[model samples]
Target: MYKIISEETDKSGMKVLNIDKSDLIELMEDYKDRKYFLSSITGVDMKDHIDVIYHLHNFDKNDYICVKVSTTDEKVPSITKLWKAAIVDEREQYDLMGITFEGHDNLRRILLPDDWVGHPLRKDYDLNKVQYVSVDRDGNEHVSFDDKEGW
Candidate 1:
């Protein structure tokens, strides 16, 4: 349902494609037949939107491809079904960028607690309003925020 918006080669000589999120699954399915390895998934919190980037490598061809999907709605379809390797990456992205991956199995915060309020990586995240939490060796949890500094 989507088309490639652009293509380019990075400094590492890897092929990169900026595509619509709607077309990611179909494109990935096509690459699956060629046996592309899922290298990594990264999320960028752009001011206007969030970008999810997927890196794939075809070892046989000595080639790498990166697919980028930018979404303003903060949501995208999960490709975890096609590449199980994306599980942790997807969760990390969701936790940090506040982007949701629909249909992802076990999508949850990977680096933050369940009670964490905001995505720390977001450009608009308020650091001064952050809560500080500490855990003792005895497994006691202490959560507090700086009232004077608002941090």
Candidate 2:
């Protein structure tokens, strides 16, 4: 029921299905109903596009499959409704890869502070600029590029 773009195997011999971003939720729902559990979500920065990978496991058969969708606009549908495990996984991807998981509730940084400037995992992330984090007396954290403010 998925509009697959291609099917391939990763180096580790895991099945990978590259499908359109629109079909992600439907395919995930079917997988969920078939007793497949969400293993994890990983994001890869391909420079021109971002690849979002969903790992699924079927405990009954001891099978594993990966679903991949590539996006140029850095957006994909959120599978959090079908898989509760996607809550944190999606957040992590969003935080580090700069991908926007559309319809994701509470989509925000899981590792970096809200004010952090950029997604460090992205290929184009600036390494020359230094960012600092400091907490104020009220226990509120602040992010800044200015070294003096951070101290």
TM-score of every prediction relative to native: 0.85, 0.95
**Model 1 misplaced regions, further than 4 Å:** 134-151
Instruction: Tell me how candidate 2 scores on lDDT.
Output: 0.91
Clashes of 2: 0
| Candidate maximizing lDDT | 2
lDDT tens per residue, model 2, 58-90: 999999999999999999999888888989999
Off by over 4 Å in 2: none
Give the number of colliding residue pairs in candidate 1: 0
Residues forming the 10-long window of minimal summed lDDT in candidate 1: 142-151
lDDT of 1 by residue, 11-122 (tens): 9887889898889998898898899978898889889888889999899997889999999999999989998888998998899889899999799988886557889899
